[model samples]
Target: MLSRSRALPAAVLMAALLGLSGCGDDTDEPTTTASDSAGATDSPTASTSPSETAAPSSARTDFCAQIPKPAIRTALYGAAIYDEAWAPGKDADVRGGVHAEGAEFGCAWTAKDGTTVTAWLFAAPVSADEGATLVKKAGAGCEHKKMRAPGADAAVTVQCISDDDTVTRTQALYGDAWLSCSLQTPGILTRLDRAADWCDAVREAALV
Candidate 1:
């Protein structure tokens, strides 16, 4: 069975493969540059941070401190879904964004049994209806589900699971973009429960 650390990388690759059509591909390998941090693009350079290559715990502290609260919330939802309790060696990653056309990129990490689960979320242009449909489709076999906040005109949630050793994942989609969340033992259903709670919390937090 796959752990949690491997999920994010696999999802990002899949998003790219499925023609995810994001605004930028910052998470790509070092060979590719990142787009504008505020919505621009640059040639991919070697990752300067240790978390990018180090274990998840170290990475999480590095990330949690750097990322904004909103982004943290997103990551938290992902983590919750994946059953990650913030183990000693478990951590997450959140990158500076480029604000793609209608999508953006964000990542999170988790670890279990010496394995890590890294999840990626890709944002895309998905209508409220479309977002609802996608989540519904993506969240098969999960209950306590309901699509709340609609993606302003265009957005949908695209989720995936990646297990590359101790890493395991249950990705979730929002808008046309994607964000992957990694966790340990809890399967897809647990992830769904967490996802639902994530949506509810985010919606409440962003109340008008």
Candidate 2:
């Protein structure tokens, strides 16, 4: 049986992907510590305040490093410059649900021309019957098709046009892992082939 708790609805996933945007550099604010205070000296009696405690470490960060830069360039096509838009431990400007769901890893790359590609993997234990059902629901109301890909137990791709942007998305299941990739390009029509490549690359890099 499919775990509804682990399976995200198609709308939630689409909203997460469409809402992605470039994250700007974060500026750190200077802070005054116990030793930095006026007339303060380095004494054993000085104690650190609760607010000065270090933040908890991120759950993960190495997810983005698995995918090579060359694969990203191929996914984005004409984009000359591209940067990592989101990764674990980064700001919540990207897919917060990915972290909320304890995703194995979620990554997004944005180009200077507003083109973006995102890939994520979720560990959902479901049978083949349930996987097919999930895939069908995800590809509803779009140009949906199924295909075979290396390392994937089952795979499907969907292409949809929203307003002035073309969105191509692919989802694949490998045992208990659910992998997905989306490519969104403004004013450009993208095909399922590119989306499939992006999905396959992610599966190869992550499932290994």
What are the Cα lDDT values of the candidates? 0.28, 0.45
Give me the displacement of residue 172 in model 2, in angstroms. Answer: 0.9
Q: lDDT value for candidate 2?
A: 0.45
Per-residue lDDT of 114 in model 1: 22
Quote the positional error of residue 200 for candidate 1 in Å: 7.8
The superposed Cα distance between candidate 1 and the true structure at residue 75, in angstroms, equals 9.7
* Clash counts for the predictions, in order: 50, 0
Q: Which digits, one per residue and each the tens of the lDDT, describe model 2 over residues 1-208? A: 1001212232333333332222110110001010000001000111211121222121122344677768888987755243432222222322223222222235566566656676665432444564565565554456665644666666777665555555566666676455666666665464567767776676666664
Report the error of model 2 at residue 99, Å. Answer: 8.1
lDDT of 1 by residue, 151-179 (tens): 43322333322232111223333433323
Q: Which ten residues in a row have the lowest lDDT in candidate 2?
A: 28-37
Model 2, runs deviating above 4 Å: 1-63, 78-104, 146-148, 188-191
Model 1 spans > 4 angstroms off: 1-104, 112-121, 140-208
Report the Cα lDDT for residue 53, model 1: 32
